[model samples]
Target: MALGGCANAWAAASSASLPFDDIAGSFAKNEIVELVEEGVVNGTGNRKFEPKKNVTRAEFVAMADRLLKLAPVDADMPSFADVPAKSWYYGWIEAAVQLGIAEGKSKSSFEPSARITRQEAAVLIVRALKVDPGSDTGSGLDYKDKSQIAPWAAPYVQAAHTLGLMGGADGKFRPVDAMTREETAAVLDRILHDNVWSKAIRQTPNMGLQLGWQNGLTTAQFKEQVKNSAVNTLVPRWFFLEYGSTPVSNHADPSLSSWAKQNNKKVWAMLGNHSDSALTHQILSDGHARAAVIQKLAGYAKTYGLSGINVDFENVNPEDRLSLTAFISEFGTSLRAAGAVLSIDVSPDLGTDWTEAFDYEALGRYADYVVLMGYDEHWDGDPVAGSVSSLPWVQSALNRMLSVVPAKKTILALPFYTRDWTLQSGGASSEELTLIQQGYRIRSVAYNRSWDSDLGQYVVSYMRQGSQHKIWVEDGRSLGLKTMMAAKRGVAGYAYWYVGAETDEIWTSLSNAIRYASY
Candidate 1:
């Protein structure tokens, strides 16, 4: 039988005897046992892992094939002088080549039996993950032998290290040293467990925002208020894509970015269409215009030293759905190259024309986090009276969104403000009021406020100026419940619509909810 065929046969049989004899007290014992059971690795014979034994290129290729579950490609194998066509490992090596996970040592020779070096392993892993090591300008390598690393492998080594797939020993990355079986197992384990495909996917708690531009709060004031809160990421509306395909700067405050950095918080520069549907459609439909906008936004993010960019394109036409996705994909590539996150704010999928323009799955694939605007269940202009974002309604929206978006890349955006509906003869009009303002209005009117468990908020109804007024208050209790729900669902995090609109108790509630959810 061919070597690759024999390897698989051995793997199938070796599952009966896990925990190789020689690996009992080894540091990599658990991982070796696990990989052996996972059929990604098999003992050399005599039921031993030989953890210290050097791994060959052919062996590593077979292991990678098993781990990645690579499908057989229906094509003629590339001719390698050293790798015979009839060899068992030949099929896996060819599969690796087809997957772009491995390459030949020379034009005509794969040197399949040669020991795999650390650098070669790094390059293979990086290629397997499809990581784009753009420019390699972030941080200098801490390895003592970094200079000895091959020029071609430097980026791969850096990327592998950044992804937590590989690390150095004694401050030295023995680039040319042969990788051991244990090391290979450990690296594969890290890839399976710890490696984040994208830096934008936060593994920790991420409480973010969409800073209300009209608040006019200085950086100092904003920092002082939220210094003790759970807020860790700030998205200030700093730029707007104007008509005529122009990128206009809004509140370009550098202090906000600096303060956020000083506090170990991330600042994402927000770019919006300013609710202009025509302008959004015009920019998205034209490829050149869209590219220009993306370029400008990427440049602005780099210039302002921002950690990321938040896309808040609203009221987009359904015709521009694919165009919007294309724009985000390109923009994300550029931003990711610059080590920046790309978050997109999408309205709740309520079967509306405006919300239908967003392709949740497509956007989730390209953008780091898809921020669900969980509010506006009933907007200011809507004739019906209802909660802005009721529990049932938000839960339904979340379920639909998660059907396409990964929970790890989803951010639940909640409303910190409520709408005060004024019922007049013509129609009902509402004013957006902060949580504190809603509280004051409720108190000043002497309205009887009661909690509606169905809506998960306090509802108030009163008469004023010959018109029946109503307020569905979104305070600590309501926001906390939503926050806990998001945490329970294992979303990336939650974001409040506006920063200054929230009450002090709202932060406490969020922090408590996060604590209770234990995510």
Candidate 2:
């Protein structure tokens, strides 16, 4: 019965049929033939796939190279002792290593023919697709019985299991067992099925894709878009009502307001982060109450013609995080429910210290979007050169965050401003000078790159004193790279810390690389 089923399956998979009994009667035989035909899996000497034999790492890679149709840019092999250039699989192994899809067990050994375990095969498939194992679904087969599977591979195992790719005969995932040729084929078939090869060939372009948090229209428009589109857009952070105290001058700059209106984007108001109830009262004290704060904010947004409001209330007491979350939740729900969108910008470490005073997950659910204020490694305090948010740090934050908030609702924040700290006694104090009146002849050394935590920007250092003082400013290269990274990560979109602070080159690079260049 299994033989008949195997033959039928093989026939279904290929355009040509193989001899029914030559090797077809063996379940493993058909799989080997199918894989060989697709050029994804191969056999040993004499055209024998050695069905029922153990598959090794080197042989597996050779198959994968042929299957995935990967092209090596160069033929150079860096000489691993176990995988010498003389080895037939050398070129294939070298290409896999360069692509970061495979690595040797030691500095000089690839263990090419060593039996590959089920978990190792999972890693290969996941790595080839550039899928971060950490980002996979947390559910799937339980690996409690698997002794050789490491803690780090847990996520990848779960991802594969959840997809129904590979499981054990007894309902457990045997991560350490040497994978048999039949077992390897079964897993490969599942992977090929789940991935759907046509997806790569039928890929579509996203050139006209609108992104970020705002649902350009109210009521039905937002409802329909939410149901249909795979991508969404988000608004960046802002101090909507705190700008100027006048009737409507207090909103975002007119140019920005107009840009939002024209582009179908939203705005995030920085209301209570720096505002106290006293400060909130002060806005009302001038004939406007807390209601005035919300009203003036809504009115100005409506007047300037905005699509939404983003609330940025940072450093509230830990106890206040919930209260603030509730307040913003109600505010966002009410405002956006009526049509306009509402978003919130919380601190990077929102899940930990009292400083992280907001329920981001809750806010993510309530607000139209979640603007993760992902910068601020060095606040105004640190004394060193670093990226505002390095890749590892950002990945750590996201790993913790995605647990609660959905990836679709998150928009990573990018910084446009840089800080220049003089190393003198009055160094930090010198920042008190206004952009216009700060003409104190501040000198600087040559430019050096550093990460600015507080402002969430990459800095170019210019020494102000004899090795004592320095100023860090944002450059175009950093901004350009950040934009590209955001797009690659499938985030809703990116939010610049402040559009006004952006230099011409920064804007040019961003627009060319990320924004509407054809416009």
- lDDT winner: 1
Q: Write out the backbone clash pairs for model 1.
A: 2-88, 3-88, 4-88, 4-89
lDDT of 1 by residue, 1-519 (tens): 699999977876665565666775567777887777667888888877888999999998888766664433222223366887678787678656633467888756899999999999998988876678776832479888888898889988999888888999999989999999999999876665654422212233444342332245677776765675567787777788887535565667888877777878788778888788888888888888878887887787887898888888888888888989999999999999888999999998878797888989999999998999999998979987778989889988998999999999998988877899988778788988887687677767856555576877667899888788888878666776777677778888777777777666456456544543442
Where is model 1 more than 4 Å wrong at Cα? Answer: 1-215, 244-250, 424-426
TM values, all candidates: 0.58, 0.45
Error of 2 at 164 (Å): 31
Residue-pair clashes per candidate, as listed? 4, 26
Each model's lDDT: 0.77, 0.54
Looking at model 2, residue 481 earns an lDDT score of 47
Cα lDDT over the full model 2: 0.54
